[model samples]
Target: MAFGTGNQIRTAGRFIRSVFLGPQLAAFLPAVMLGAYWFGGEGVLLVAAVILPALIAFAGLASRGLDLRSPRDSVTGLPGRDHLVRHLDITARATGGNDSQARVGLVIEIDNFRGLQGMYGESGAEAILRQTSERIAGVMRRDDLIASLGNGRFGIAMEKTPRVDLETMIRLSTRLQEAIAAPFSIDGARILVTACVGFALPGRVPDQTGDAYLAAAESALAEAQRSGPASIRAFTRAMRPRVSVPDALTKEVVRALEDGQIRPWFQPQISTDTGALTGFEALARWEHPEKGRIAPGAFLPAIARAGLFERLGEVILFNALTAIREWDRAGLEVPTVAVNFSPDELRNPELFDKLRWELDRFDLAPERLTIEVLEDVVAKSDDDVVTRNIAALSKLGCPIDLDDFGTGHASIANIRRFNVNRIKIDRSFVTRVDTDRDQQNMVAAILTMAERLGLATLGEGVESHGEHAMLSQLGCSHVQGYSIAKPMPFEETGAWIIENQRRICDHPRLPRQAG
Candidate 1:
């Protein structure tokens, strides 16, 4: 009870500090003074000033802190994004004036930060950010500037000195990564953090602006992120051209779709309790004639940019339905095949009609098809077409699964509004469920909420026997990831079914057949 009281007092103190120190307090002070004057005149005003002089002083500090033109981040007290950009601009101009001098700009992103925020609450995440910023600051030279780039990302501007070379910058970046990668103790839990570093040297692009350098650095950062944790990539000329090349590749994506080169690969979903095959998620894969097998990440964005998502979605849907029909004919008891619907595809008025037509054309049961919607799309989009089509699909007996459940701005309202049938706990939460207590608690909460709502739960990215067992013990209905099976071609799926049949039939706990 004493601890609870102390917590409440601390919470109240934080509220008071925020009220006094927040930017809006300055705007509200005059109204407050006026109310004071109107109610009790000079005596009350004097009393208020005497009692609240510290607040008034803090408000003055807040005004300076809240200045829009200020270069500092309010939370971390480090240089903000605009400050870093402006610093880059100044450095670029200075370097342009002196042909011998150059600058290096870097962007560092904390990978899986959204997952961290999900496991730890906002305050805990902010505490980690503060510690991260401080550690990065500790690694930098006095002249080098680091700034908060928002969203668990940071920007660094380093002016090239006579003592510093490309090797020096590389070493500095490595040091920064090492410092940040060290475990942080927050809220009594030790959490390991990893960062992706991307750096650009001005010598590489003598004619480009600071913003251009930053963009190049971001490209390198994206590549580093793709390479996974604690990775670094330096910007190169080849990366620059690849930016514009996506436009050309968009055409290739369209061609692939039309030429039947884009095909659906099935990643199996299994029941956690029974180890039976539940369903398959139809993932899109492109077989480019020239490039060979193109990953979806390489081409899906291009397809979306070309406004061909709807067409590509249709092709995937058709292929998935055809595969299900073929599996049925092959005497495989695969129950359903899930296909993702992008926001644009969901917003299409013809979505329901197209799905209904395809289901009827294949003579497949509506229950045999699952429609997956990303949580962000359902939570953030206010499209009537999407809303109506989801409802229509639900009414047509197609189960709706909320994909990437914990990573979005999803709420109870969103689940209720969309009438979600199943919630797929994102890979972020499922990755280390067996080891991480926070992850275990998060998954348990999600499962409990889903259970009370009468919705099923599937854990995506379940990779180990331990994770699968833990999820089953926690009441997750289904699991999917590489541990079960990689996404395979339609032809191979039949053989896989035959190979796994005995395990399915022999399990002590037989899973209820999924529609």
Candidate 2:
């Protein structure tokens, strides 16, 4: 029979009780006469025969009781592997979907489940599994499906969801957060367990069956697991392809780095107070022979994977320093030029020595180059090692600026730990400064903190007059945004500077560009 509902069980229990206890008492009374008849006389035999039907009814009632066994594991009392598969099969047959709007899957694997087993023993792991299962079961709806996909990995499938309905998906994620956040009790001790979840929406329907949506979810889940516990990542188009860059293209990129095809485009950084060009933040570009010019984001990661970042950093630095020397010769009076340094470049023990050697090679003053380190790399790194390297680089007379300051989780700690020369507010904040109260407050707080620490501040991504006016009012000393100038090639920057100098000489305040 179908398991039916809880109300059915309760009604059944009551009916069984009535059969045994209501008019059923008369049936048992005759059974007493039958027992007496077996010992007494033939007259009692008639009474015993009449009681037989009542005895049968009472026996049926005795069998009705609740099954109280825990259906799943103790640590995560999720159902056993077979039970999970059954759940998946039922759901897949009934409601699974093929499109992004209609399908979603979750693959959650407890990070290092066996490590906990080693620490607490097999029995301890069992207890944890039971508790974990109870929590997970409590969080899920009756109709939703979950399956133990083996080795501490569980799969969840949500049918009929769209990318735009991600808020609903996030609500499901909260259940996982709650389940993992609550500490599991194992052997009289509370052990905190953390897990990472990877999720995907089915792109197509199964031709073969056996929960194809579950498999896609598992793939996304594995990526999240590799990234580490507590990290969640969704599958994207980039993760779908396994294609490698052509060998010729790879070689061309490497060749470009070696042949000085790489150059820095200096976007002028303006002084909010003086409204004149203060410096430039150097951005790297490759004038590929075929592609013409490739943005850094398009190919940098691939190049870094091929172990070319250190060489690439050196090339960009060489070009930027060369440009700085030329700018000085042209009497630009620029104070600094910020160049981005990759973590791969910074982590190199000999990076400082190599930078010094390059500075000497081009006769560039160390004070003119401000190395901009990404916040994420600095935050994740061995701070002591990075701090020492930054100090050594500082002693060489070049300052260090913390780039993309508010972008990472550990920004505040990074600012305090490193002897940074400047903090540039990330463009995301500056782009909407006029309308976003939170962004305005964040920018204000960063400026206030930098001032107290006595470090210079630069606001990046100032695209409008309102943004510029706001930053100026808040005493942001250095600013870079399209309102001033877009990132241009070095030659263009030079031309714009001459024009700006002419305009300033004519009028004290630079006029706003025509809308």
Candidate 3:
């Protein structure tokens, strides 16, 4: 009775075909028998009845077999891309006149899907794909059409309805992201797959083809993939061809690295209880000749696209270490300087050696530097190189702090695998802690977990005194954000430190302690 199995449906179809054909053949056989007159009436009737029905049944079986083999994804049972396009065309034509009704299309791609498929064999991979499809289907409305675009990509079309405004569509897309990001169990191995989602809204262009809408969505998808895992981007006219930096600018980024034009800006991390400066996180800044000062968001992608991420990291590391050494010589008592490492930089075979070389060059200890890695970076537990590098760094005595902790799906696993020494609660959670009970509870839970794990906690982006006070009460070890101090160049750090010392001494609310 269950239609879940394809074989069962095929069996039922065969039975229905036999029933239809048997009656038609029974009537035809009597006429054939009378015309042929090859035997006595009764004898001819019997022979014709059996022979005709058998022949008709054979034809029906063939037709049913073809229907069962119709174009569909063999694994997920979703329609093929061609069918999706046809459906979109129909919707476009049906709603062409209704200006209020606009069609929205989405393209969802599993990030690093091929790598997952390769790790698990064909059967296991197919199971994951089927589960992913099911999760997506669970979130869609009855009228929304979904299809397999092959190569671990799925397409969705949501026709405009009274309830489905732009905001609703965005919320739905976010739900899809969360759905796919949930952990999966395949062949006794637990795995997590993030998604890159892109959407295209109805455009103003006259008579835009279905392919154009799909093309726009794909363009946005590419942008999301470059941005990172679990990213969502919406297509716009400006994003028509693609989003990219010029090759000349990329080359200049490389030159900037070599010329020491990219420098480190230090943001102090202060103790919540003692109000003493504990450390500084070295943030990268580009001193472009024409641009004057370029933020990391502007040039970091270019550097990564140009495959110069490792070089940029090296520059940042060298500069941070040099600044720390200089600070020490200036009679400043800065305890530690944290430097960020990208996933690619962490996986480099010479990462450990490079760190050691930089430490030795600056005549500094490894403990003086904290290695900050993004939560998503540490989530790649399957990468042996990444895991090994992290272990080596930890063994070398550099504290590993998981940056942007709660934003990622793999926080607990990352902490267990990387032996993290600190967890920096992301600003999103910290910024609203004072106003939102849910935010406060979430921060409380994170601090509780860190305490149990014997790890330190730092509250980032603490722009308000309420947030700072809340974090302090919650037992956060350190705090860093606009409220404490803005990131400044090496030359300005001494003056800022002196100013902060004076202010902390003047204010009774802030407790002062020896550096």
- TM-scores for all predictions: 0.59, 0.51, 0.53
RMSD of each: 14.5, 13.4, 11.0
Best by TM-score: 1
lDDT of 3 by residue, 293-408 (tens): 66565587788789988887888888889888888988888889999998889889888888988888888988899999888677655788888888898999999989877655
> Of the pair 1 and 2, which is ahead by lDDT?
1
Tens digits of per-residue lDDT for model 2, 97-167: 43544435677777667556655677877776666655666777654556555556677655443452445
lDDT of each: 0.80, 0.67, 0.78
Model 3 pairs whose backbones collide: none
Give the CA lDDT, 0 to 100, for residue 118 in model 2: 53
Instruction: Score candidate 1 by lDDT.
Output: 0.80
Ten contiguous residues minimizing lDDT sum, candidate 2: 61-70
